[model samples]
Target: MLAKRALSIAGGLAVLGWPFAVWLALTYPELHILLPILALCFVLRLCALRGKTGALSRAFKGLALAGAVLCIASIWMREAQLLLWYPVVVNAVMLTLFGSSLFSRMTIVERLARWREGELPPEGVRYTRKVTQIWCFFFLFNGSVSLFTCLAGNIHWWTLWNGMVSYLLMGLLFACEWLVRQRVRRRYE
Candidate 1:
């Protein structure tokens, strides 16, 4: 489980650093040649998942397989615009996950908070629900901007927003939420 989590963290960082990877690939032809190796890594990770049963798990495995295929295909084709599409797709997937959870028994944020706090008070539960809603909106807006930048065909602008600006905004949101949660817990708990 630790190895799986580490791999997940590395994969997320790779996605976040994709623009830099592209720069390196362009600067050194040998780096571009590593695409197949990356694809193999994806395939290996997928194979390691053998027998996971949840819908979310299956969906993620499918996405990983598709990513592997895309990596291999991109090597033979000239679909450079995919670099722009990646962030948009990733944000959309995340948005779907968060948005769908809002209609379930508990929002994703609530579920996470409960994992830490065990049973939350009614107020805490309500607050987590609101936070999850805010996250859904954030993902929607972020994905929209990513799609707009992709269509605009400016790699620099896409990289600027997706790589740096989007992450900063997310970090700001996370920090603000943490601060607010602390204050709320002190007052009501």
Candidate 2:
């Protein structure tokens, strides 16, 4: 159990630090060295998810599998350029997961909100659905920018956008959402 937890942490870090890893790869060994490490991380992540069964778990497993496959292909083909697509792929997977949740009984945001507050009233449900839609739009916009960076073939631009700017944008969005949620909750109360 401890080992699994450790692996899960490692996997999470690998994902969160992906842009830094890519920057290091670009700076040092031309990304050849990083591909194998990324593949290992993805594999470990998948292993950590073993015995978990749910739509969310399945989505995460699929993401790790996709990452592993991308790294493996980059290694096999000896094409470091292929590594640039990982961010785009990540966003695409996220968009799919969040967008699909809209049609389900609960939006992804609603599911998360439920975890914090037992059950949601009608207003909460509507709010979460709107929040989920906002997130879907963010993912779409972010992914488009990521794809643009990849196609531009400029490492500095790619690193800056993917590594720094995107994270800042996401954080800002999250902060804004939290503030809005507070107001919504107060009004509903």
TM for every model, in the order presented, reads: 0.81, 0.94
Q: Stretches of candidate 2 above 4 Å error? A: none
Tens digits of per-residue lDDT, candidate 1, 87-147, equal 6766777788778888999887887898798999999989999998899899899999989
Give the winner by lDDT.
2
Q: Please give the lDDT score at residue 121 for candidate 2.
A: 98
Which residue pairs in candidate 1 have backbone atoms (N, alpha carbon, C) closer than 3 angstroms, thus clashing?
none
Pick out the ten consecutive residues of candidate 2 with the lowest summed lDDT: 23-32
Superposition TM-score, candidate 1 onto the true structure: 0.81
